[model samples]
Target: EIESIANHYGWQIIEQEIDKDHIHILIRYSPKWSILEIVRLLKQLTTYRMWQKHEVYLCRHFWKERTFWSDGYFSCSIGNVSKEIIQKYIQEQGR
Candidate 1:
């Protein structure tokens, strides 16, 4: 899902790893890339896919609400951290 979003916006994924509850991926792209637009498209696509595939489950969970996601997401950049450090951190999680 994340990869698709990043790819649609011409972002490059340098590294990726998945944890129990979250995913960590290092992505880069042209300076003109709009983070907001990318995020919006991702959320929309995921929501649509989930709705189509999990309609019954979703309806059972909450008929009043229609959002698969809680609200927002977390994002940050590593300014001083080296690529090796980040890769090691992600790798260590797998062990």
Candidate 2:
């Protein structure tokens, strides 16, 4: 579902994983899209869809103004390490 939304907006998802508390997504986007823009779109679309599907359940757990993801996120430019290495690292998460 996140892949679909990202593709709709011209972002390429290289790899992804959803864990119990968070998600790991490796994306390649064009320069026209800033980090802030990409993050906003991803969070907004995914949160809206998730809330639509699990409003009651999410509200039960969150119980704070109906938010799914955290207001803050951690992101960094991919360099030095190869993309394959990063993909492998993400795949190894939660193991």
Q: Output the TM-score of candidate 2.
A: 0.89
Q: Which ten residues in a row have the lowest lDDT in candidate 1?
A: 33-42
lDDT of each: 0.74, 0.87
Candidate 2 lDDT over 1-95, as tens digits, reads 78898889888999888788888889999899898988888899888999999998898888868677788888888879899999998898877
C-alpha root-mean-square deviation, candidate 2:
1.3
What lDDT, from 0 to 1, does candidate 2 have?
0.87
**Per-prediction count of colliding residue pairs?**
0, 0
The model with the greatest lDDT is: 2
Cα deviation at 59, candidate 2, in Å, is 2.8
How far off is residue 46 in model 2, in Å? 1.0
TM for candidate 1 is: 0.70
Estimated TM-score for each candidate: 0.70, 0.89
